[model samples]
Target chain A: MYIHAVSHYFPSEVVGNEHFTRLNGLSSEWITERTGIRERRKAAPDENTNTMALEAVRRLFDQTAIDPSQIDLIVGATYTPYDTIVTLAHVVQHNLGVPDIPVISVSTACSSLINAVEVVEGYFAMNKATLAVVVVSEHNTAYNNETDTVSGHLWGDGAAALLISKERISDEDMTIHTIITGGAATSGKATTGVMLKPLEQGVLMPHGRDVFINACLYMPKVSLQVLEKHNLTIDDVDYLIPHQANLRISLNVINTLKLPETKLLSNIQKLGNTGCAGCAIALSENRALFKKGQNIVLTVFGGGYSFGAMLVEV
Target chain B: MYIHAVSHYFPSEVVGNEHFTRLNGLSSEWITERTGIRERRKAAPDENTNTMALEAVRRLFDQTAIDPSQIDLIVGATYTPYDTIVTLAHVVQHNLGVPDIPVISVSTACSSLINAVEVVEGYFAMNKATLAVVVVSEHNTAYNNETDTVSGHLWGDGAAALLISKERISDEDMTIHTIITGGAATSGKATTGVMLKPLEQGVLMPHGRDVFINACLYMPKVSLQVLEKHNLTIDDVDYLIPHQANLRISLNVINTLKLPETKLLSNIQKLGNTGCAGCAIALSENRALFKKGQNIVLTVFGGGYSFGAMLVEV
Candidate 1:
């Protein structure tokens, strides 16, 4: 499988650190030094996960000039949907006017986007589908409570779309080398303390430090395992696309992996942590600047202690 | 991929048609005649999607004697989850002590179980994993509002687990001939009138008739298409395992496909529509009675208007 096009959409409204500083009674610099997020986009009242996903895919179609009818599979990765009855992928399918084809929603929180890629690779490998589209739309605001000063300031709304095919459509297409061959580990029964329980108003995540510590450890471990599967070393990787959750976690992984500082491609400073869309969004934003034969490694950790890694060749 | 083991778990409490008849002021005979459901299990307030799924997988482990450590992947299919933060698959992974493997939650509403199978087939096709476990746990009661007379009486809670492997575990194992080769079509913009909108109580389905008609039409269409893909006709199909949403819908599909009435194996009379777990539960219950070298067609339609079919050889 290869990626023909990549595009992302952020909501119109841009929020700065001052927004959280006022509510949390902390200085903007203190928040920025702690999280490394400058400004993040928040969705408008009418905009939602489905609509944002649709916008991102529309951009992909516009950039690649690919017919929507040619897309035989649609995979939507989102922990947050407008509702459970109808999935975000279904709404995007309805909006795109794409006929039939399997539209699947795979949720592993932050790892969801990469996991969806693995799911689509199955269809491509089985010859069940030739052209597939994956969209990662996250409304982290839906799960983040305003009063929860810790997690509230970390979430931003965003969506990223990828057009992948069994056959490369253009010379510029990035071929997937090993589509999600690594393993995923969860924190298991220890999930109670660091939790996101459903509340009347969205959900609640009580422990941020526990998530941060586990993420910093697991992200590097999974990425290395994926590299080992292919008999490749860290030196073979030209770029690292760690999940853009926080600058600190990305830096931690970089230090742990002993990769060059310039090898890390990130947009977390501008986008905040977009949940499942983090790595995909960062990849899309930096794909154009990457060389044709560069090797990129994507590592992600999600809430509920889910973590995974996938190595891709550009 | 071959099916090594399949097991299902339903809640302890059994609610008969009399329970609904008394509440709705309708006769038990009328309820049974309208829908082939006589009794359905309702999960205890304590039993959730994750716990039910865990129980089902535990049964599969005991029945097949397969080591949990040998399992390479876990794909959970569910529309109703305990919460969005941690998926049912993640919880099951924790309970089972399954090692570091990819645990994915794929939701296509009621079509989720079959679609998850399709996703697993891809992994098996790519040799990403050898032994994969699929658990379909639906808490239909979570979204059912008791006051909603039209849709309320239709839902039942249940969970089913399937162990699919690239290699056959035993001579009695059912081999997959054509694993989800057909296209899945959604009803598109026609979904507004019939939807499960998020509400304070849970979710609400405003239109059931539209869903009934669509399921009846698409169920047979996708099934026959899959059969056609394998260059086989309905005559080759020894059993028809359609989603157990309603007996009338299943009957309509069997009649339209011109399949033998005796070939239609269903448990809707005892277990109300189990959502994603419906067909899997039915298949597990009837697999022992099936003969070797027999062919079975599984067709499913889900909310979000998603539907698909897969053909398998016993």
Candidate 2:
């Protein structure tokens, strides 16, 4: 499967640590030094997962001439969907005026986009579809706790959309080659550590260091596995688009892989970690950095101890 | 793709309208009349998606005599997950001691299990895996508001697992022949009169009447499409296992198809709507009813406006 175009959308409202300073005695430097996030976009009360997805898909529509109706499948990847039963993908299809096509929602935390891509690839390979659209959106701020400096400063709200098709324009048009994807629990205790308790009314409590260590270790190993499968070395990869979990984790993987800084792509410095939207946001921001025949590696680690890697040739 | 064995896990804690009447002002007859759910199970506070899935998978393992490590892929179907990230499939793998494999969580609401099965078939057809597991779990009660009679009485929690493989055992074994799947949606407009807020959390608000109409019209049509592709007719089908959405909907579909009641397999009267777990649970409950060379039709419709139908020969 080939990625035809990528786009992302962040709400206009930006919230920085300064705003949290008033609610919880914290400083911008303290938040930035630890999480590497200066400011993150916060959706207005009226905006939601569907709205964010719409914004990104609209830009994607503008970038490509492919009509929404031409799309054979729609996959929406998210964790914080507005409803637990009704998927945001259907909402996207409704907004796009293409309701008859199948729309599937996938949740793999930050790795959701990769999971979505994997499903799309499987569908295309089986001749089940010709064109597919994957939209990853997250409103983590809705689940954030202002007093919890660890997770509060590390998350933002955003969405991204990518169109995949079997009709490749060129052999170098960034085809998804292979993926090594799975997850494991390191919490030792089953069910206890993985549970997220609601705080006050809507706050989300997360174990940051646990997630951090898992991402740092699992991502590089999976990326290498994918690379090895294609008989390609790390040196052959032109770019690394690791999930925007954090600058530290991404940097650690890059260093461990011994990849140069020029070969790495990231936007977490400004966009923060958009949960499921992280990888797609990174791809959308770095779409221009890719050229025909260039190879790129995308890796992600998210909740449920989920980590995945995909190798694609541009 | 061939189904090796199927198993289900129903939570021990059964909660009927009698239980609801004691806790919240409600009646069994009222609940039954509105949603056709006589009773539903609620997992203990300690029970979750992963544990429930593990229970079902263990039963499958016991019956099939297959080691967990031998499974090449794990497809988890659910909307309510313990974590927003990381799929519950990995949790099952970790507990079962399975090797690292490509695990994904599919959320197409009620159609999720069938969607996962569709994915499994594609992967098998592509020679990507020889053995795969599809686990569907839903914890709707966790999100249901006791005060909301509409949804509270309609939803249930349970899990089911199906072992699928490319190695067909015998002509007597059930095998998927064809799947016709897709979805449709309406813009969230008051004028559409196709929207209903069923939860105070406002996550999965759906118009029940609209969904019923869509299912009644699309499900049988898709089933016929699958049958036509396979050069079969309704008379050739020995049984119909429709998604356990509602008794009225199922009965209406049966009437429309003009199929005999003896040819239809149903468990909604006891299990209610278990979301993604619906199809697997129905199959497992009625396994003995199927014989070799007998054809069965599985149809589903759920949130995302997603609907699908598949023809399988037992």
> Per-prediction DockQ, in order?
0.49, 0.47
How well is each residue in A1-314 modelled by candidate 1, as lDDT tens digits? Answer: 79899999999899888888788876778778888898888999888787899899889898887888788888999887765657778877777777677788888878787788888888888887899889999877766776666667878999999999999899888877664522334463335423444434544556666767777888888888888888899999998898888898899899999998899988888888898898888888887788877889988887765777778788
Error of 2 at B83 (Å): 2.5
User: Which sections of candidate 2 miss by over 4 Å?
Assistant: A170-172, A186-207, B19-35, B169-172, B186-199, B202-206
The residue pairs found clashing in candidate 1 are none
List model 2 lDDT by residue over B205-241, tens digit each. Answer: 3466767777787778888888999999888988888
Candidate achieving the largest lDDT: 1
Minimal lDDT window, size 10, model 1 chain A: A181-190
> Per-residue lDDT tens digits of candidate 2, residues A152-246?
56678999998898788444356888877765543332223233322123324356666667778788998998999999999998999898867
Candidate 1 DockQ score?
A: 0.49
| i-RMS of candidate 2 | 4.0
